[model samples]
Target: MASQKPFIAEHIYADAQTGSTPILLIHGFNSNGAQDWDGQQWLAPLKAAGRKIIVVDLPAHGESARVDVPEDATVSKIVATLSEIIDNHGGKADVVGYSLGARLAWALASQRPERVNKLVLGGLSAGDPFAMLDYDAARKFADEGVTPEDEMTAMIASMAMGEGKDSHSLLNLMQGLGREPFDPSVEKPAAPTLLAAGLEDPMAGSVDAIEPFLDNNKTVRVPGDHFSALKSDAFKQETFAFLGIAH
Candidate 1:
């Protein structure tokens, strides 16, 4: 039996400037806020700008580790939980999400528009590649150290077994995420959005895969691959400007 807890591990960075709207930071799949933002030196600028920051460790990731996901834990449920977090903090937050976090953030913008002000999506595709992945394959590799020839499968398996991470919990989380029917074209989130795609990243088809969906987004090309993009200096510069932190 899985714990009924919401698995909300939150950390707050208070602004020196009073009444500043907070920005929510959501990390990618198999990553944590500490490594994604704090460890990567992102929090410094936000803190210096006197903007409150909120970072959450999503289910089965980082500090919110539970081996099994709750039965009722669907994508919608997770979005709603995030909404409540925003509401509790100050209401109407700006969101920044990377990869898996981007997917959830986009859903939040659609389903709970009132909770979001501006959205920033990084390292995202207009598709759900994870759904096509074999969770069993990833799990077997993590549990038994069996490697997969498939690049994506191998990547996921490696991340699942990262330092201090639980492979079983990742399997449970990935299974739940696999059930989500995500089609960005069919269901677009109408919000002021920014897309940070890496030029060398395969996910962006070398700047072609995202062409169809760039209508409303402000796209910026950063130098790096999928993982390295998060820590790119160009990405940080563009992101800071977009988020309205004056140079």
Candidate 2:
């Protein structure tokens, strides 16, 4: 893993030895790149398949420095950051994002269609209704100086997990994100795209909410809830196949 200072910002990277097709992996809210990918065992198979990988920690998360433009830092900032990394590596690359990362991926694919070759969005939808409520609640929490360890965070975890269990880690993450709007509008993507969510993910709820936003893109539903989606081997295979990398 290497630390990259691009766009005057610091982010972590894990390069693949074979470097076949470059794929950028973006982590979810409150989670770092390694914690998201490594914890789920998603990166190893991609590496073994000879695919170059790039993982980034979003602003206010992981080793990346906090941005002064938290309110201004919409999903577009994430897209620009990935664009900068892809440009530094080459000109274009495939992108894979989970949760909040997936939301950013959608924004990136919509904004800079040419910069991304392929895209995979996991555990989220472009205009998920649940996300709007979360956005409001998170903003309120941030205003109240509440950290991720707050009751609201546990509620979110319970909802996303669909098991009615509280997660301290999830609360800490919500606090880390501070307050940001969750806005996912319809945008045409220039590359092949895939949208995925856990079958029981309360956050995503149903595929119906996402279908209208996707421009005829592929959708995959794997077993489990938000946390378990990453653990699904079926998800890994489908994701790798979508990126055109052998599993």
Candidate 3:
């Protein structure tokens, strides 16, 4: 069991540049900013392009920081933290979020459109099953590495654990997200955004399920599933191009 005490999110800046509008990178569940961006080799190129990269370790993933409160891992809270980051760096920047990070990005752009310039939401879909899960039961099943009754949730749990996440902490993350149906009633994310999904990736959900609800959007299909897609150079190409910093 890891420390449950709330803490500040860990973040790193690449090539700190004054007055240069930064681009924020948010990683997926069980993964940290280093693994998703720097480890994946995305950081160097963006740095070379003279872009300031602000990579965040979304609570308890990389650099092991917790939210302000144990129960504050919700998208709203995540966005609030992110807003603070953007504020510190001049209050408006582009954003790139992967998987679970993408979900939080959606909430951020929808709720704080002015804070985002160009948005790239990678690995997302219409519904989030984690919201429907029984946190306690799922956490227990995950600890055992098996949930016979619900294969999907079990696999998701396994994936989270595979990323080196403690089962209970991951459960806390999902719980902060709460169990709420996808809300289209909220204002659509107005930022210039791209929805990037891999054809083979069902784990990230379906782009079809929610793309229709978003305006000011472009869609791109890269060559790998959830994890691999992020590792793909094509994915990087798409991202760089969408961010308008592509070579």
Instruction: Rate residue 205 of model 3 by lDDT.
Output: 49
How high is the CA lDDT of each candidate model?
A: 0.79, 0.65, 0.76
Off by over 4 Å in 3: 1-8, 16-18, 66-70, 142-148, 162-164, 180-185
Tell me the RMSD of model 3 versus the true structure.
Answer: 3.1
- What are the TM-scores, per candidate, against the unseen true structure? 0.87, 0.73, 0.88
Q: Write the per-residue lDDT of candidate 3 for residues 1-247, one digit (tens) a residue.
A: 8655334355655675566679899888777788888643787777777778888877767665544343657667678888988888888989899988888888888888889998898998677777666555576776675464666666666665654456677667776775443464555688888999887898654686677787789998998988899888888899998887755
Q: What does candidate 2's lDDT look like per residue over 129-219, in tens digits?
A: 3332344344444445344455644355443332332233343334333334445443656578788889999776655576665665898
Query: Order the candidates by lDDT, highest first — what do you get?
Result: 1, 3, 2
